[model samples]
Target: MSEATTHQIPGLKQKKVFKIIVLGDSGVGKTCLTYRFCEGQFLDKSEATIGVDFRERNIKIGHEDIKLQLWDTAGQERFRKSMVQHYYRNVHAVVIVYDVTKPETFHSIASWMQEVESHGLMRAPRVLVGNKCDCGTPESRLATTYAQRLADKYGMPLFETSALLDSECDNVESIFMTLAHKLYSKQPLRVVSVEGELGPGVVTLGRQKRSASSNDSCLCS
Candidate 1:
């Protein structure tokens, strides 16, 4: 067997790591989502992420230890140019998040999607996340139809979650875990064939298919 394939064998391995990038507009809770998944704690408020912040989490999947190197980028408009110029080149997966309560945040999805495409990372695995679902306010509750439309347009998996309640938070990890497994196994990343053109689609990087539905309630305002 090839060296790469041999590493995937159970109980016969060396250290392996995967790099993941979290991209979204400022105040869209990108950091919160990372923290919630990595540390299992949520801060009510946080300063905007500077140039980038790094977090590492080890998750075991089917007898393999996958070390996730998560890169969180600053989402302010000022940082956009720099990210486009230098940040996304080495990323394995991209998580695009937006605040469900703020339609404007939702509207900006197209712009972020554009950025991802500009970098030619469209083939990368992407997970569309709608945050702040626990608020239960009219604004925070995103219509399933709207999310599905976006998902179909991008050929990506759409997941709605609330970091405050930890709902479907594990699902976020699962998405990345599946991606890592495929990458380690040397399989091609899966791509969904979007039906219509709503906007530019993201690059998908895994072969496994998952439902475009929210698994639990973990919304926060």
Candidate 2:
């Protein structure tokens, strides 16, 4: 990584880099949610995060090449207590998650959000998600009215997502895509000179091909 990354929408090497931080209480499926976003397949028994984990994926929004650096923060209080504030610094977006089956997890979002406000860069695009919606009726427990109100209050998109559901795969991807677009759209486009005519059609990210190890866990080196 450079000493610092730029947020320019496009350039000769405009990668449209964005650092996204995923936060929630432990067992809220933060890891699974991230893995699903990065790998497009859910792991029901993936290894638990001891402190933090990360994965990167590149995407395209119009002609801009966008790269997402997703940081999966350990949600346990013990881990949070010792983590430096810089862990949340200079982020381009935030993803706050909770378990739909667990009301307490949803309730804990306030404290989690507060921690973010205290530590994170201001005005980053934020998303709120209710994970693990695959196991049960996704809408039965959480009040959509209340969640919408919360989202409106913070100007964030709220979603009830299931990493395990094929239908919900787009929802997970949309959170980051929307954020990337928002960041890219706001900036003035630059006319960067390149060697030849750019190819047509979307450039595949090449990250969707995830293979499982001998123990049946998705592994990406």
Candidate 3:
């Protein structure tokens, strides 16, 4: 795991941090998708998330060094209202992930969306991701047509990704980059790069009642 240099970058003059939450049901490969994008590797037989794990990375979009706080919340149904509630604070964008091979996971998007919306981030930019495209046969893959329909219904951009294949890494990264651009283009967010900042790949979790560190907050002026 790469140590986060987000807080350690010298001469980080201007920076903005955007909070993005990944939502889905259990066993949908949410964690794998996150690790693939942040660390560029896949975890096999990974245990489910206990609470939430977030990674911070600063990606330059045009002239802006935007620090992205990617929060990978536990997709277990039990965490939706209670655990997810504490972490959703200041979320700027949300990515609802579903497994392409699991119809039930895809179906849970609506419920997940509802939980997120109720948390006062309804105006945040939302994206629908169908993950784990590398799994299952073509016949078992969730229909892109149906996924697109759902995306349209929610007015969220839809993306299908595979983390196991190295070639698809760009596709996965683009999802966050695109939203960062969209978010920056919408408003000039106020985030000052601070000393002692952490890197994006840093993972923070708990066995229960978990929340991301306050350092992830973007102090918008």
Count of steric clashes across candidates, in order: 14, 0, 5
lDDT of 2 by residue, 40-90 (tens): 888878876878788989888766578888999887888887773556765
Task: Give the local distance difference test score of model 2.
Answer: 0.73
| Per-residue lDDT value at 215 in model 1 | 27
Each prediction's TM-score versus the true structure = 0.74, 0.75, 0.77
lDDT of 3: 0.77
Best-to-worst order by lDDT is 3, 2, 1
| Residue pairs in collision within model 3 | 4-199, 7-197, 55-200, 56-200, 57-200
TM-score of 2: 0.75
**Relative to the unseen true structure, what is the Cα RMSD of model 1?**
13.1
Q: Which structure is stronger by lDDT: 1 or 2?
A: 2
Which has the greatest lDDT? 3
Each model's C-alpha lDDT?
Answer: 0.71, 0.73, 0.77
Model 2 Cα RMSD, Å?
16.1
Best by TM-score: 3
Q: How far is 177's C-alpha from truth in model 3 (Å)? A: 0.8
lDDT tens readout by residue for model 1, 52-147:
888889977568677888888888888778554565756767788988887788888899899889877687778888888776677557786898
